[model samples]
Target chain A: MMQQTSDKKWFDELVVELRLRQVHGSAIGDTVASARELLRDTGQPAEEAFGPARDYAAALEFPAAPGHDWVRQALWPSLLGLLAFLLFNQAVTAWTQQELLLVSPAQLALLATPVVLVALLPLYLDAVVRRLWVGIAIAAICAVAGVLSAVVAPTQPSDAWLAIDPSPWLIGTALVMVVLSVRNTVRSSRAADDDEIIDPLSGTTAGTGAGARILVHVTNWLFPVLALAMLGLALALR
Target chain B: MSTSTPDVRATDGVDWPSDWLRATLGFLALRALSGGPSYGYAIISELERHGFGAIKGGTLYPLLTRYEAAGLLTTEWRAGDGGPGRKYFALTEQGRAELTRLSADWRRFVASSVHYLDPERPEKEISP
Candidate 1:
């Protein structure tokens, strides 16, 4: 435990330095890589970098930003789960055309409330706050689902697999549960050891022209928007 | 082989530093640099901002010198925005590639770990 704490402290300290903009932008890669190299060279077991694992998941929720590191890894899966719920809700509503059976806009907003709130909050808050936010979000989903299920139960048609309108609340809750479960698994993995660093000795770049670099940056920002627009067009045309 | 005494292996079961530490250090440095370029002091300060205050001058200075020597990082001497001239360090392409590789590995590690720890569905398990 002591060793783990120290490792976390060590990594945390490095992050602090980086956040202050002290490290030269060009050397950032090497500084991080070298520190990691030193640790391995010194024979310490690498800590796990768990947060980046969920980057794909989070990208589902928000536009991707470079170098946010763990935020994407941690919140992404949750965001994806929420997105699935939203999509599923839309599908069910479009299919059933029942306002009560599906989630109302208010409920959808409520469902998103916890995650967006947690996300928008300043990072300076306590870790405990983050944990609680996650927990409360899960609980809220379940509660909303339960209420929806009860309300929808009596309205089911005889041939329907579900007796009532499929409650958007219930579906959303289930989705939240799925996301939370994933997050728990992620959290347990490698024990959130703050000590873990990524690869070192990997500082090579393609060194394209300045124009190319700007183009790359601009394209990164635009790719998601273009994709989203395309998706919207497809949905509208469908 | 010259004149130094031969090193002996430790009989005690204490674990020495491993490659993980070195990789972690390098990853952190790269992440820091992604923000902007800086000299030693600026890098140190940046580390502090990221919640890594324990990295003092003793550990940081030698590491910077070594990185410069390896050409993984390049330094240009520049007058300070406010004060004296300082050596600025930036990532070479080789260094940036290293960061990408490390980041991917880190993500993989996290995913595998999560897979092991919570393999079951949430509805299946109830916590007290």
Candidate 2:
């Protein structure tokens, strides 16, 4: 029983390592299926037969998508969504109260903290995945920056770095958020469960459970959903 | 290359040096496929049955993947005997030719070493 649990973790690690290399989903499925087949044949635990999952993944040398493809397709889009979300957050409250959106230099710097952190994620992404503390530290930093940005927000035009009408920023950012979320929705829907790991013999694919599928769509629309909630909250307070 | 070939034991001990096995496993693997297509466990079993100490799947699969990548081998997923599908690896024409070339070179090198290391040979005469 204990052996099975540990082997499960090792297999999970193997999947992650392979994904980090940007290996195609079908290839990842094939690799996992073959590894499991060998384990069954030998009746040896996965680690014993395959050595360390990380090392084994590295050894396979399966062809992968170029490293930067995800950055171009996924990261840049997420960053833009994030920028729109942040702008919406700032603009929503001011629009609700019929006031100009206030911005200070310090507040803008604080707002950029998470965006810059996420932009550079491709460089330290592997490290962040491998180390729990690194991910937590980054999340903590972003959260702190968010709170600090709110605290430093200018209260009046005299004290503000830039004070502007909230309506245009509000409408524009909401449109960007909606457009991005729609794009993500279409992409994810088309992909469906195609990325799931499949068993060659059984023709069964994993990660396609109804709950999991729902979660993927929710993630794709995360920023727009969050923005809607924030707008609701601001209206309630106003 | 050495015509002074003397009658020697047809086989050596199974305890070959690790370095020796490392250098030649790629060729031995191709030779294993010379019989027919085989899967990972079957290939490992064949080498072990022939006295290569149990080769780990970790060691063998990567070698097969590399050979496949180099077009020296091809692999297929085939249904097993009421079991999960197996990935069968078969040598390509290039692989067969490589095996032939490597086998000849290996035999000549072994023969040269055996001739030079003959106990009856005067070592002092050959000393630099």
Candidate 3:
């Protein structure tokens, strides 16, 4: 049991390393299955049979998908959704209070913090995924920036740099979020098979269960769902 | 009870220089697959039984992957007999031809090396 757990962790690391290299899902699956086959035959621990997961992943030469494919497919849409979600959050409370939405330069800059961090993710994504501390540090920075943005928001229109009726902004941001979520959902369900890692022995993808489907759905709708929660909280507080 | 050599390192009884093994493992692997389709562990065992040192999967799989990409070897994943599926590698025609060529060249090289190293040969033949 202990060996199995460690081997599972090793395999998980291998998968992540391969993903970082942008190997196709089917090729990743085949690499994983073959490695597992050797381990079973030799009765050797995974790390012993294969060297470090990262090095092993680098050693295998598989045809990777185009390098910037994810940028077009996933990153841009997610970033846009994030922008819309932030706009919705800012507008929700003002609409709830039946007041104008106030925007200050400092507030705008602060709100852009997470968006900028996310945009720069592809640059250091491997380090962020490989090192736990990097991920935690980024999350901490985003959280601090989020709290500071709320604190700096103007209470009165006179104190704000720009003020406008909150109704259109609220409606527009919500529409954007919903549309992006729908598009993401459709794309994911269609592309899931192409991106899934299959276990050759079991004749199944890594996760084909109800739980996995639910997780994918939740991921597809995350931004909109969070926006709705923020709206409810603003209404309740008002 | 046995005497140990002063400069010898312990190994799995057959410890050829690592460089030599690294250089020849490609053709050796091709030769292994020449008999029939074989999985990774079987290929390693075949090489070890023939007096080559144990080859780690870490070292062997990458070479196999390269050959597969180069069209020298083809692979198939088949269900095992009451066990997990196995990925078997077989030599392509190109791989067999490569093995044949490498083996003949290696034999000729070995023969020349043996002739040059023979103590009974005249000094003038190697004077240069």
Candidate 2 per-residue C-alpha lDDT over A86-130 given as tens digits, one digit per residue, 9 for 90 to 100: 999999999999999989999999999999999999999999999
Q: Backbone clashes in each candidate structure, one number apiece?
A: 85, 0, 0
TM-scores for the candidates: 0.29, 0.93, 0.92
Instruction: Output the lDDT of residue A160, model 2.
Output: 95
lDDT of 3 at A180: 92
| Tens-digit lDDT track of model 3 for B13-37 | 6888999999899988888888789
Residues A80-109 of candidate 3 have per-residue lDDT tens digits of: 999999999999999999999999989999
- Full candidate order by TM-score, most accurate first: 2, 3, 1
Predicted structure 3: lDDT = 0.89
Which scores better on DockQ, 1 or 2? 2
Residue runs of model 2 more than 4 Å from their true location after superposition: A191-198, A202-204, B1-15
**Docking quality tier of candidate 3?**
medium
**Top DockQ hit:** 2
Give the candidates in order of DockQ, highest first: 2, 3, 1
lDDT of 2 by residue, B26-98 (tens): 9888988888888888877777666677778898888888889899999888987776688888989999999
Q: In TM-score terms, which candidate is top?
A: 2
Off by over 4 Å in 3: B1-12, B116-127
Q: Judge candidate 2 against the unseen true structure and give its global Cα lDDT, from 0 to 1.
A: 0.87
Candidate 1 vs candidate 2: which has greater TM-score? 2
